[model samples]
Target: MRYNRNEAFRFAFKEPLHARFSIYEVNGKEVETTEGEIQLMDLSPSGAKTYTELNIPYTANNSVKITIHFQLNESTYNFKGKIVWKKVWSDGFMYGVSFLVNEDMQQEIVKQLKIHVKSLKN
Candidate 1:
C-alpha cells in the first residue's frame, strides 16, 4: 500500500484510549524523564497520533526516542517511537509519533489495527 507523506490515513477511534509515555533519551543523552498521560487518538501501521495534557515544548523536527505504554485485553503493550511533530495548544500538546518497528512488528501493528477496525464496525 502506498501512502502519501503529506496526508496520513489514520483509524480514529470513538473512545480514545489512555496511555503513558516516557522520554527516555534525547539527542543520545539520557535525561530526567517526565512521565505523562496521552490520549491515543488514531493508529496506523506507520505510527500514531496522541493528545496529552502535558506541555512538552520541543522544537519542530527534533528527534527523541520514547516508549508508550498502554493496555489492551488485560495485557500491557509498550511500543518504541520517535517524535516527528509537536503542536502546542492552549491546554496541552498534540504529538505525532512514528513507530520504530521492524517488519514483524509492522505486521503485528497492522493486524491489531485491522482487528480494532473490524470491532468498531459491529
Candidate 2:
C-alpha cells in the first residue's frame, strides 16, 4: 500500500512519528480533560496534520481554536492553534491545525524536527 499525497513531511523522515498531545483549550475556553495521543502524520514549523481519537464537533461554520501541548526531543511545547480542517476516518479524526507561534517557536520546531531526523539515521 502507498500514499499518493505529495506531502513534504511524509518524504523527509521516511517513518512514522507520533506525538502525545492534549487539547488544553477549545474555542478559546480552557478545558479540563484527559490527554489523548495523536499521530503527527504531517509536521512543519507552523502547523501539523494529526490523527487522533479526539473529536471536537464543528458546526455553524465556527472554528475550533485550541491550545495544544506536546513533547518533542525531550522538550515540551505549547502552541495555540486553529483547527483549520477536519475529517472523520474509520477509527479516528484527522485534523489540520495551524499553529499561532512566534518566530522563535517556529525556529524551535524546525530545530527539533532536524534533531529527530538525525536520530533516525543512528
Candidate 3:
C-alpha cells in the first residue's frame, strides 16, 4: 500500500508514556541520553507516532531505550522500546518506537488497544 506523507490520523485515546532514550551513535562509541514524556497519538503495524518534550536528533536505525507506561487490566504496565523513527515537531520530537523483549507486555497493550477500539466502534 502507498501512503501520502501529509496525512492526518486521529487517535482514539492519548495514552501517556514516559521514557529515557539512551542514544548511541558513531559505531557504538558515542552515547547521549534524554528523558521525556510522550503522548502516543496513533499506532499501526509499522510504528507509533508519539509527541515528546525531548527533541532527539536521530537518523533511521538509531537505537534507543524507551521506558513507557500503559494501563491494562486496571494496572499500570511499564516497558522499554527501541527507537525506529524520529521526526521533529513544533513542541518536540516525535518518535516511532518498537517494543522490545516483552511479549506479555505487548499482549497487554494490544488487549487494551483492542478494547478501546472496540468501544469506539460501538
Candidate 4:
C-alpha cells in the first residue's frame, strides 16, 4: 500500500545536532541504544528523514519502536518512531522514520521544528 506523500522541507542549522536513539519493542522491552550525530534532512508532520551513521543494520518495514532524544534551544525532546525505510551504506545506514505519535505529539513535533527553524534564522 502506498502511503500519502508528505512534503519534506529541509532545515539548515548553524551548529550540528545529534539525535540519541534507542530501539525497543512496543511492549517496552529494551533492544539497543546508540548515540549518533544526525542531520535533520527533511521533515513532515508524520515523518522525518535523518542522516546518521549506524553501526547496525535495520531492515525496511522493521517496526522500530525508538525513543529519539535531542536538544533544541537547550531543552531536550524525546520522540518515538518506526523505521519505514532503510538504506545501508558502506559505513552506516539511513532511515526514514515514521512517527508513532498521537495528535498531540504530532502537533508538538511540528511546533518544535518550526521553533528550531526560526532559531536558525536569528
Q: Give the winner by TM-score.
A: 1
TM-score of each: 0.82, 0.74, 0.59, 0.69
Candidates in order have lDDT scores of 0.76, 0.69, 0.56, 0.63
Model 2: per-residue lDDT, tens digit, 3-120? 2354223223354356665556666667666666777676787787778877776443776666677777788887778788888976888888888888898788878887877777
Hey, what RMSD does candidate 3 come out at?
5.8
| Candidate 3 structure lDDT | 0.56
The digit string of per-residue lDDT tens for model 4 on 5-62 reads 4433444344446677777653345676655566555555676667677643455434
Across 51-119, the per-residue lDDT of candidate 3 in tens digits comes to 777766557654555556654335565555567787788868778766564556555556666666676
Instruction: After superposing candidate 3 on the true structure, give the runs of residues whose Cα lies further than 4 Å from its correct spot.
Output: 1-35, 44-47, 118-122
Stretches off by above 4 angstroms in model 2 are 1-33
Candidate structures ordered by TM-score, highest first? 1, 2, 4, 3
lDDT of 2: 0.69
C-alpha displacement of 92 in model 3, angstroms? 1.5
Pairs with steric clashes in candidate 4: none
Query: Which scores higher on lDDT, 1 or 4?
Result: 1
Q: How many clashes show up per model?
A: 0, 0, 0, 0
Tens digits of per-residue lDDT, candidate 1, 44-72, equal: 76788889988664666555878899864
Q: Which stretches of candidate 1 lie over 4 Å from their true place?
A: 1-9, 32-34, 73-75
